[model samples]
Target: MLVQKNVPLQGLNSFHIVARAQALAHITSEADVKSLLADPAWASEPKFVLGGGSNIVLTGDVKPLVLKVEVLGRQVVGETAKAVIVEAGAGEDWHAFVAWTLAQGLPGLENMALIPGTVGAAPVQNIGAYGVELQDRFESLDAIDLQTGETFTLNAGQCAFGYRDSVFKHSSSGKQDGGYSPIGLKDRALILRVRFALPKPWKPVLGYADIDKKMAEHCTDQPTAQQLFDWVCEVRHAKLPDPAVIGNAGSFFKNPTVSPEQCTDIIGRDPKVVYYPLPDGSFKLAAGWLIDACGWRGKSVGMAGVYEKQALVLVNRGSVDGPDGATGGEVMTLAKAIQTSVYERFGILLEPEPVVV
Candidate 1:
């Protein structure tokens, strides 16, 4: 464990926002977490667990003791008749792991290729793309309790996974009646590793229009896992801004799910509203389309701006390498404006995808 004071965090976050962690500790193993917890100075201090910093917006210098997870390793842990279990340390880069799985002849994670952040963070958001979600492949995960320094593992049901939500994203008041109800571990447990159950005889998850467009352009019907991975990467590169070049947290808002009655009401107002039917009988509205309809594309507030190509993404219009970048407050301001406009015009409030700190 390496602890540093006043650690610069602009480079750590995908948004490239200028901020500092009052105290930051780079934890490379479970031993590091135990060691940190044993320290009297830090044992009771409020703590913040940071993964790849991809899914967070730093509004100001962080006050909590930042535990930056850096544990690393990956391997095929077990294989059954129906599935192959692969385990990876929490710090593994999500996209790199996806690519690695394809190279190793494991093909189930191809649809979610090119996603940013670490494997530990993936479960927190239940990150999904091209009709595949983290929960669809998740087996289990190992995490440590910050309060008691005890380690534990949890299965999918125990995670309480939801759309862009998980038990890891909520906090508990410690008032539960002896069972894991709604009380969550949010910031109370630091994930050490994650395991995925890649199903055998992988079947392609292809329903998105982009994949269909790719199939049409290539004159091929059945693409292999590697082919699908390549296509998803290609599609995402064309649509989303690269964090290394343009600095952004991909997809700033979650697609709002509405009941059939609410969908009918919106469609009545605008005949061209884009929507997709979910398996749960609710319609998922395109948040980007809603923002675009409200004339927010290519707009800005201070140094925060919306991507001209995709309104779902918010970009940093400030310096990429200096202290002068889009402040988190400015980004939130732009997001709030878009949210209010969308709600006023469509009667649906948009929820932000990234955690704001």
Candidate 2:
């Protein structure tokens, strides 16, 4: 375990926001985690677990001790004629894992290529892209109980996955009569490792309309997993700003899902509204369409602005003219504006995907 105090978190998070953590610990093994938990210094203090830091936004300096998970390994644990079971450390980079799987001719995860964040955090949000979700390939995950300092294995069902949510995220502080308790800084449980079952023959799934169109345009009758992965990277690169170049999370808000009646009412106002029918008999509206329709694209407030290329992304355009250049971008306010605009335009609420701090 490596420990530091008063660490700058600006570069750690993808958003490039300047924030500080009172203490930060890098854990490379389960034993290291156990040792840290045994320390009296952290006994009652709040704790925060961070991975690649792609899916989080720090509003201000975080008070808790940030534990950076560094445990790393990838192995093919089991194999059959049709499928293979691969286990990856929770701290492994998600995109790196996807590339590795594709290199090994694994069929799944191609659609999730170029996604930021770590493997451990994938199940927390049930990360998805291009019509594929992590839950579809997830087998199980090993998590450490913060209270008992014991590890527990949770199957897919045990994870209680919903769209962009999981038991780890919803029940980080355990369950309550109303629902899962609110997540507290120190009380959140930690993920250790994840197991995925991927197909062996490596058949690609081309469900997304844009991806399919791209493939067809290229005149490729049978696009390999690598080809598909490359295409996804290109698409994402074109649509989303690279956090390294511009400070922004990939997608700020999830596409809102509403009842059929709600969709009808929304479309009754505008006939060209884009929507996708959900399996639950609901309608999922395009959040970007709504934001763009509201004329927020490329709009800026101080240093914060919506990405011109993709309205779903909010960007930080460097320091604003203020004393000490202290006028930092406000993501919450922009998000709230987008949320209110969507609500007013279509009477549907848009929820942010990134964890707000």
lDDT values of the candidates? 0.92, 0.81
Positional deviation of 309 in candidate 1, in angstroms?
0.9
TM-score per candidate: 0.97, 0.92
Q: Evaluated with TM-score, which candidate comes out highest?
A: 1
Worst 10 residues of 2 by lDDT: 319-328
Q: List where candidate 1 sits over 4 angstroms from the true fold.
A: 173-182
lDDT score for candidate 2 against the true structure: 0.81
List model 1 lDDT by residue over 98-144, tens digit each.
99998899989999999999999999999999999999999999988
Candidate closest to the true structure, highest lDDT: 1
